[model samples]
Target chain A: MGEKIKVDRVTKTFVVRDSDQKGARKEFTAISNMEFSVKEGEFLTIVGPSGCGKSTLLDLLGGLSTPTKGRILLDGQEIKGPGLDRGTVFQQYALFPWKTARGNIEFGLEAKGIPKREWRAQSDHYLELVGLKSFADRYPHELSGGMKQRVAIARSLAFNPDVLLMDEPFAALDAQTRETLQSELLRIWEKTKKTIIFITHGIDEAVYLGQRVVILSANPGRIKKIVEIPLKHRLADADIRSNPEFVKARHQVWSLLHEDEYAGLYI
Target chain B: MVAISKQVKSAKRLHKLTINPLLALQKLVKQSIVLLLFFVVWEIAPRIGLVDPAFFPAFSEVASAWWNMLLSNELFSHFSASITRSIAGFGLAIAIAIPLGLVIGWYPIARDLLNPILELFRNTAALALLPVFILLLGIGETSKIAIVFFACTWPILLNTIAAVRNVDPLLIKSARSMNISSFSLFYKVILPASIPTMFTGIRMAGTGAILVLIAAEMVGAKEGLGYFITYSQYNFMIPEMYAGILTISILGLIINYGLLALEKRLSRWKQDPTV
Candidate 1:
């Protein structure tokens, strides 16, 4: 498979006002010289301690923010700004409160320049894909946290982006809901066949979802190690998370994160 | 059987919600029993001389005075005149304030240039500047409308700025990733997000429009509820004065509910109303 995305020596830094010294500025590197590549149709899950720039990396991939020192490429083309080629599902769901579940889905199609007539069918198709066909007319506030996130996923997928960028999409949900969504997301990803980049703080989630887990350490985040999860079965099976291989992969990612010892403080 | 009946009861409630809002109003009317009792006390108090009839006329007397003015077409003329001025001033304030507020809120340059001036004028009460409006615009329809216009501007402007500024950042980020245009971003996301807060300002400005217009009219005017009430008070037509005051109270309520209804319509997706 060809490289779907390449994070080539990318480093993101911010010039924040120095707290101790008045009027002085200091450079804080969120991520330093991060280099990685994702193959076509690969499920890449990134895990890190807090402030390890996992989110900053996602923002760079989504083209919402620019890397301070290096460039990110999608299909070998430099990403200048956010476009329909990539779909993003945020942790907050970020569903338009004024739009219905279907309306939110239709908004993506509209942004993709799909005609008004095809919107209903296309949106309904994606809504069904996320098992939210019944909630087509329901508004964001009327939905549970899980349902809202499902609608967010439906809206993102409805746009038919080649790559799915999810930034801890299930982090806000309850334990049961989060587990359920994780399974559903995997199902959706398999069916859609999109290159997926999932960012999470959970060790089990990273190990379970990713074909390869990119473990990042904090304080100028650099990749500690990338653990490959060789699961016996791949799909939405809750039992798979408890499998021996799954447990082993999860353990590997956990220790990699804890390598710096500061991971315990954050945890 | 008990479970079946409970489901039926909920089904009936659902039917009322979808089909007949009048059935819903039954709940509201039942809650208004205290208001009904207040009217009853008001009717009997003056009749028994618990309150002076010359000053605080019986509820029946006020009703009769309201009826007579209605019969003479005097009520309609004054009502129309007051409504026209209120609508004109209120409409003009919204037309001006909402757009300006969006610009001021969305753009730092506009906010920086106009914020100090806004803070200065916003502090000076519209009622305090009634004389200035009357002095400059003269004691005419222009002054009455101008005073209302002045009073209505601040709330709508401030609220709109707040609405524009406070849109959820994550929502914007999510939309931008969809490759939405800047124009579509404002229309599709920011404007709708701001509607709830802007309506709050509009509702406040609605109250301000009536309050300041009445005051402005009371100072010098010929045909408003304020004028009618003051005129009747001076002529010792105590029932008529009370009737005019009653009309103002009703008008205030109607305007408030009207705005509420509007907010509900615009923000149909808003389950919990902040207002």
Candidate 2:
């Protein structure tokens, strides 16, 4: 596998005015000296506690925000700003409320200057891939949470970006829907072979979905450890959760994240 | 169980046939009865000497006066003149306010420079500036149109600014991540997102245009609904004045409904019945 993304010594600082104290300002370090690398076509998941800067790191990778210290690279080119090379799926399911599911899916394609004649067929394909063919005409407000997320995924995939940056895309969903989407996402990743950087706060999800799970420590967010799951094969069935290797991998990530200071905080 | 199920099915069919139509018919009847009662009282009160006939005319007398004005073409000319002036002023306000609002809302520097001035002018009543407008533009169509423009501009401008600024940040972030060009971003995301709020401002400005125009006419115009009503009052033509007032009310209603229909068409996505 080739190196797809390289995050080298990235640090993000936010300067906030102290509203309670007159003329006082403070600097906050969200992530400090964070470094990681992802291989091409790999499903890499980063799991962390709240405020661990998982989303911030993903933002940097997607070129939505600039790092205060180091830099990120894609295919040996330093990331400067948002581009079509990296497609991001936000936790809020950021489909334009004014557009229907099909329109939302076609948004990035349209931005890429694709011919108008191809937009419908391209959008229809993605909609079908996400199992939302019947709901192509529905607006975001008319869709359920799971359905909205599916549309969001379809939209990002239709753009055919080099990498998919998902920041807790399934966090808002219920348990059953989340599981169903998790399987669907795996199936998509296998078929498309697109590099995915998935960020989540769920330990079970990180182990279940990622080829390598990177556990992040809070308080100036930094990577604590990276664990590689030794599954015999890629998840081909929903019953993988019952396999010994899966449970063991989940427990290993849990203990690492559940250490003294962060104990009792549910992942 | 079978008998109970059969009875329930029959009851459902009965409800669909009778209750639904009965409810709709009842609503129509209720509304008509209220309007009819109002007209009946209006017709009877003045004729029975419940009020002074010089000041208060019966419904029939007002209707006949309205017909007379229509035949003479006096009401039509005044009505058309008022409509044309108001529409011109309202259109000018929309053309200016929307672009200004979009620029100010999008750029912090522009907002900072203009906010104080906007607040100052918005708070000052447009009617209070009629004398100044007349002095500047002279007591002609220009001055009347200017006053209407001033009255309508503030609401549309302020609402548009608020709308553009308050668009969900996540939507913009998502759009930007797709590498959308700035022009496409504004056209596809920002403008559409801000439309509902912008429409609110437009509707307010529409109402404001008519109001300010009528007030300006009342103060110093020779032709308009306001002038027609005031002239009739001065000459003690009570029924003619009532007719003018009714005409103005109907005009306001028509403007409001037209704007409402436009808003509905533009924002059909908002009406999610399933939600």
Candidate 3:
């Protein structure tokens, strides 16, 4: 499978107040000349520093916001605002607090106008996929942070969208939980074979999960380099940590980030 | 350290046994004490001549008047009349406010055109329109009920508009991405989320309906608690007037509790987790 979604020369800028001038607004660029494409059923992660506008790029692809310039195409069609083909999972769980886990997962299918009987089976299937079958009847507040994030992923995937866009879904969890959820997410990705574009601030997460890691620079975020992962199958977590080549890639990415950070301060 | 640990364990057991029962009794005993204090003051005020017995009837006199009203079955008739009017008027308001609010809230042009007019009318006292309603509808049940409807509608309409307008943007975006579009969006996404807030408005409208009913009855109606109070005052039946006031208070309490119970049942999802 090759390239289900393509972004071309996407640029997004918001108006900001000029620091030196009183009451004067200036154009502040968030993302400039950003270009990428997700191969059909490929899992990719974009990793960068805090203000690199990784989220801005995700929103553009997810169709929550329109790019100021250029275009995004899915299956050779120009992308418009949010469509059913692309599903997004936010950093916060964003599940409806009023709905139980089952209710929330079924929301997408409900909107699709599926019959009520079908919703029960479909929703329960996805609930079990995320290992929340036991807690299906429970509300969002009933779950811990990791469980809530799992529910969010289940909700996005329940509708069987063509592309999944996730914006740092597990960043809020503790270190141990984050690692666990990362592996769970990889497992889900492998089983489902859905095209995924994940945004993150963590280097380890990007290297661990991505077929191709797109490193972005801060201040008018642009792609600095694309690092391809050669390891094809699941490697032991300890083995990946101990590999000499993995250490080299980590250090190389760290230095690139350092350069971007220093350059950003002067700007 | 061993002795200290044993003492802490015993204290924990003691706490488990006594705390729950003590909390329940504390709540009940506190309320009972307040009521007892009120009755004590009421009984003493007339006997001590703090207030003259002629104008301010004794507690026993008011109690006897209450018993007489109940025995005559007149109190029940007045209570029923007031309740029917308030409920009918409030029901009418709900029928009108919901669709109008949705239209106005969803469309910016409609909201800009209509909102100022709504704000103007809401601030205008509903009782001030009583004479106008009487002039138009001829001082009968229609005029009185119209007044109650006018008073009750504003809160419901305003709250509907607010709840619709203030739905979280993130939720809407999330819904749209999931392919939830215009019509289903309102019913599934907007309406369910807005319900808790909308129920707040409904509760307010319930109170407003009862309040306006009382005032409306004072004008020309023959069969409500407000009319009974006015009639008693006219005939110099001071104790009976107090009895009517007491009946209205209990009626208000019942209506409030009824709406609250319904709200709780409908909004189980919003139940506070801490409790």
Candidate 4:
């Protein structure tokens, strides 16, 4: 019950049934022999190619589904199923379409039977934290792509979960909005300092957001490397894209990825 | 170019205001005209000898019979009895069907187990089983209510299941991630999402329940509009039968309009994306 989380040699396999009339089933290994530990108050990112099962690993860690083998531990206790300790934000902005932004944020608290007066104050606070105070009454369909995600983040954060798990939460947003929300997330992260595990297919985003970025292989998703950033503080959105160290680290990761594809750098 | 586009937008706005309202007015006017034409034809056709006067009574004759029934309070008694039975059956059906449907839809195992039995029972038409209901419960209020319940429960149950099953999985995932429990999950998330569709089911059930009760009342009912219709027809009072028919249709229209208002209130958030 001391450390934040530890993924101990987790291996997840899916039985992909063959569409051929013969009715054969084949095993598709999603994550194999994955081992990692997330420290308390750490921001860790897992990044790889689109089909690399980065999301699957997050699901495994969050106990959305069980792995075929190995176990994930949160605070040295084995994770069994979805619990109050870990909160998730889905990439597709999974805000309930029927609920207003304030309602969605208040839902978790309401489930716990929190008094209406307290829930109102806390929900408003989270809405303000995500800079979506004006959009409190708006439904998911009324909000823009970015606004929906901000509300999603607010809902997850409102419960004050021990660990925050994000699965490429900003991937669907336009580039400008993505970066703006990234900085907003950084500000929120600084204030809360909760343990976070973010999964992404975007390398630059992984490097920018993570204190340590863990890269995984394509299929049979296995951990390849973990790169630690030297900086103590997150860079400003403008500064992040322009910083020499950020650019250099990003290029290095890009080359490592592209090297697997083409076997040589062109420039 | 921007100014021209803005001016074009304004022009389009004006065009919409002029044309859309006229289109809506035309629709309303057209419906009213069709109703007026039907009444006029009915009024004139019998006198002009275009159709048999025996089968088709004059509109004036029907209206006079309606007035007579109203003055004698016979129509009120029949109407009130029919309405009470219909509403009571509908309320009971809703009480049973909605919770059961939600359970079957929310849990896959329950749906898988119960679906075959439900489908088999649903296929047995409520009218065809009227004799069986009469045998089991006697030819009383029990039999009539049983028939209406059978007719009404299917639509409500099926619609509720459809609504619950079709609720977007994304919403469920979001709610789960927020640590919402299994019980509150259904009420807070699933119920709200399923309401518009559930309303459609209940409204359909309301009309079906009334129709079934009318037929049921024809079989041994002492006090109901259906009995009044058959009694008048047997007595060779064509206008009274026509008045009963008109009353039933008006009842249906009121139920439909009431549900429509409720649906509009509940689905305030579901705006057309194209707009």
Q: Judged by lDDT, which candidate is best?
A: 2
Clashing pairs in 1: none
Candidate 1 chain A has its poorest 10 consecutive residues by lDDT at A229-238
Model 1: residues with Cα > 4 Å off, grouped in runs: A236-238, B1-26, B273-275
Residues A1-267 of candidate 1 have per-residue lDDT tens digits of 899999999999999899999999999999999999999999999998887898899989999889888899999999888989999999999999999999999999999999999998998798888776766887887677888888899888898889999999889988877877887788887888999999998988898889999988888888878888887456735488777888888888877777664656765
lDDT of 4 by residue, A123-178 (tens): 98998898778668877776777778888898888888889999999999888778
Give the TM-score of each candidate.
0.94, 0.92, 0.89, 0.86
Give the docking tier of candidate 4: acceptable
lDDT of 4 by residue, B1-275 (tens): 23324433543463363548879999899889989999999999998999878877899988998999999999999999998888888889999999999999999999999999989988888889999999999987888887888899999999999999999887787676555678877888899999988988999898898788889888878989899889989998888999998999988888788877888788877765445
Worst 10 residues of 3 chain B by lDDT: B1-10
Q: How much is the TM-score of the A chain of model 1?
A: 0.97
Better of 1 and 4 by DockQ: 1
Off by over 4 Å in 3: A13-28, A230-235, A238-246, A261-267, B1-23, B58-60
Q: Candidate 3, overall lDDT? A: 0.83
DockQ ranking of the models: 1, 2, 3, 4
Q: Over the stretch B160-256, how does candidate 3's per-residue lDDT look in tens digits?
A: 8888999888788778777666888888888877878788888899888888889888888888999999999999999899889889888888888
Better lDDT candidate (1, 3): 1
lDDT of 4: 0.83
Give the poorly placed runs of model 2, Cα more than 4 Å off: A18-21, A232-235, A262-267, B1-23, B26-37, B47-49, B272-275
DockQ of 4: 0.27
Return the clash pairs for model 4, or none: none
DockQ of 1: 0.52
